[model samples]
Target: MAAYTQDAILLLGDSLAQGKFDRAGLADRLACVYVRKMDVINRGLGGYNTDWAIPVAEQVLAQQHEQHRVPRVQLLIIWTNFVHLVNMVRSPASAYYSPNTRVILITPPPVNTHQRTDRSFADTESYAEAVKEVGAQVSVPVADVWTEIWEAAGWDELACEQFLFDGLHLNAAGYEIVFNSIMKIIEERYPEIHYEKLQTVFPHWSEVNVNDPRPSLVKRRVPIV
Candidate 1:
């Protein structure tokens, strides 16, 4: 494993990491609990999948020196599934990434509308499985957002109706929940980043209202249009 003494988080992936929550911004809430030395960068692009992650990764490599034994510039929090690009980059994956990079793969959550009659559970499961499969190529840790919250009241579930202002995006509370889950995963699996105390990325975050709007649970299913 490449060891990086730097304090930073490089988030890359799809719109999910881009904060699809309404009521509570999942990534915003996450910034509070990092509780360590790190810089968080949200590089998630809407509509991106695994295939596209390659070029992005390549661009990142350009900024690095081709040398080992050096600290990494950032920690990779990739929330992508560019399956289209996988085949192109799979062989000699070393060409795509620098030795100084550490990776965390976040699986795509079930963005499909869940109706009692809709049978797309399998698709979410497949997305989760795809995350694991893709991670194998890069040898990175995969955060199975799909498995973590797939069964947990989706758009079809009454508890999740209001949770997602719309059918796919999460409300503030919804983002908050997912944010917490991500923190727990980082703490447990990625001990290197587990700073003993809360670390602040933004200097002004302290002045910001930490609790302007307290988190609340909403369980009303939005009617299907």
Candidate 2:
């Protein structure tokens, strides 16, 4: 069998990261946009805060290192609830173990209290600020979803509901904001790794020669140094 390989974009967080709200969540939108260039992995754990995610994330990085898979991590996106912002921000730093692995800390979006009682908008904002502080301390990029979504909604509570499926989780419109923000960061700071700039695994079908197809199908092998 041919060894399969691709770049990776890892999503780690709670119910929001897991895409509990919609079929097409953050990871899904990114996958569609970066199709064939990178594989988007969703490691979202429902109801688990950042404290629980620390060890799990460490193990995941270790496993990836040991496995020596073709799909190396290019981007690691993390977003979780406010209850454990401090630990969550500190823990995901281990992702740097893999060289060239870019990290993006996403703050949870604003909550619509009318929909649920598990959390409050004020509480979530404080945590979002905490996440931004962590991102700055670690020198990692932050999506700041909380601020972006609220601004997009013109800071109106009722208007913001369109971005969320429930009081806490993001809906399609909300995820789009995140996806755009992330891509903006990548485009500005890490243009080299931008999906549009990367080459596809194979040439476009129109570019392939019909006769003597082996030359088109097989790549020239390079000698190991």
Give me candidate 2's TM-score against the actual structure: 0.84
| Over 4 Å off, model 2 | 63-67, 81-96, 218-225
Query: How many clashing pairs per prediction, in order?
Result: 14, 0
Error of 2 at 121 (Å): 1.5
Model 1: per-residue lDDT, tens digit, 1-225?
A: 734433445666667777753425545565555533454566667776666767776664433234344423345666666543333333445454444445666665555455333545567668778778877765666776665555576434445544456555566655656676666766776655554433333333445555662222222111111
Q: CA lDDT, every prediction?
A: 0.55, 0.73
Best by TM-score, which number? Answer: 2
List, residue by residue over 1-225, the lDDT tens digit for candidate 2.
Answer: 646456678888888888854576888888887776677889988888778887777655544335365556777787853323323334545332455567778888988888867778898899999888877776777888899998998998778888988767788888889889889988987777788877655656776889876678653221110
Weakest ten-residue segment in model 1 by summed lDDT: 216-225
Question: Where does the lowest 10-residue lDDT sum fall in candidate 2?
Answer: 81-90
